[model samples]
Target: MPFIIGTPIPDNKILVQSVSHIYGIGLSKSKMLCQRAGFGDDSRGLNVTPHKSKFLENLMDKSNLLLGADLRRFQNDKIRKLYTIMTYRGLRHKKGLPVRGQRTHTNAKKRAHFNTNVS
Candidate 1:
């Protein structure tokens, strides 16, 4: 396939999967990211330019993708922000109800350690 935007994509079919190789980017979201970055829906894994590669690497690193950011970065950030709001102990203070949302009275067994029976 012709190189997209003058960038040579990697020949590895697996690497071009968008979501599998990238952190903070899921299959769907990866498509969006590629779209945003002007990378069309081509199955080719463009070898990011040196500058682009550095930019992406740095971006991923700063975004807390130490292990990976493909899709978890978004979730990680959300959970982290919630925990910060409750001072890391808000979960316990609020009876294990997720500070973000979720019905506590019926579907919160994992967090209810004070006096709840899982069975």
Candidate 2:
């Protein structure tokens, strides 16, 4: 395993896949990063070289991209704001119910009764 942007990825992970271990970068963004870093399909990096790591750090800094703990904190802050605002979704979230308007008539059976004996 190796660390990129403070996230550990499997040693054998593809270059594009390796970059996606960071919280904010998805597959598409990872491909873009690999291309920008000149890491091609053949670059089976055993580990990120110091030069490559430095380049990536600079790129992320220039792009103002948030990763890892920073992204998690941002997401948590947004959810916490919703809770403080008492939004319908926040109430639903607090109740452990579907917050996306999902039908609950046949699904949220917290105390469903079942017959136990054959007549």
Candidate 3:
């Protein structure tokens, strides 16, 4: 059987890489998770035993790291707060412009195009 984390199993990937399929988990974190789960770095996803998978699931549950829907919800909430506060970043988000002060005149063509398309 395939191991399911935040989503469907990535049976074709190496176990270290496969764990990164979970939202919010990056390559470094995935490697850390493999170590903590007592799985070797070279382990393949299909070779993950039920016990190891369960151990991983439990570790994720106990960790502060958010995955999948929870991470999305947290980000959405943060953006909502920014929007509600009417900060500069919020205004940029509302206007569909770059928020980090990237030069909009030359850069952010995609965002500019998106704004124009909406009208």
Candidate 4:
């Protein structure tokens, strides 16, 4: 398994999928990264040689994309900011409920179950 940005790439997965295991990267972005790194569709994670991996890493570094833990931290900070401002979405997050206008009339029972904070 190759480690990229402190995340492990599953050797059994196809290269693009394995790359997508990294946070903030999805299927399309992973495919683009692989294409940029000169990897083909059939490439597996195990085929990521040190040089190729380095090239991939360099590509990620050079790109202005926010990724991995930094991306996660940035999102969390945004949520935290919303919470400080007491926004509706922040309240929903604090209540452990769906924040995107999801109706809690019925399907949100599971979320309600975890919402121990009453009022």
The lDDT, on a scale of 0 to 1, for candidate 2 is: 0.73
- Which pairs of residues collide in model 2? none
TM-score of each: 0.34, 0.79, 0.85, 0.89
Write candidate 4's Cα lDDT for 12-51 as tens digits.
7889988888888899989999999999999998889888
lDDT, candidates in the order shown: 0.50, 0.73, 0.81, 0.89
Q: Write the per-residue lDDT of candidate 2 for residues 1-119, one digit (tens) a residue.
A: 55667877666767777777788989898887777887886565575777887787677777787787898999888877887899997766656667788887998655223323212
Each model's number of backbone clashes? 13, 0, 0, 0
Weakest ten-residue segment in model 4 by summed lDDT: 110-119
Candidate number achieving the greatest lDDT relative to the actual structure: 4
- The runs of at least 3 residues in candidate 1 whose Cα sits more than 4 Å from the true structure, single-residue gaps closed, are 1-10, 14-16, 55-119
lDDT against true structure, model 1: 0.50
The C-alpha stretches of model 2 lying farther than 4 A from their native spots are 108-119
User: What's the candidate order when arranged by decreasing lDDT?
Assistant: 4, 3, 2, 1
Which regions of candidate 3 are displaced past 4 Å?
A: 1-3, 115-119
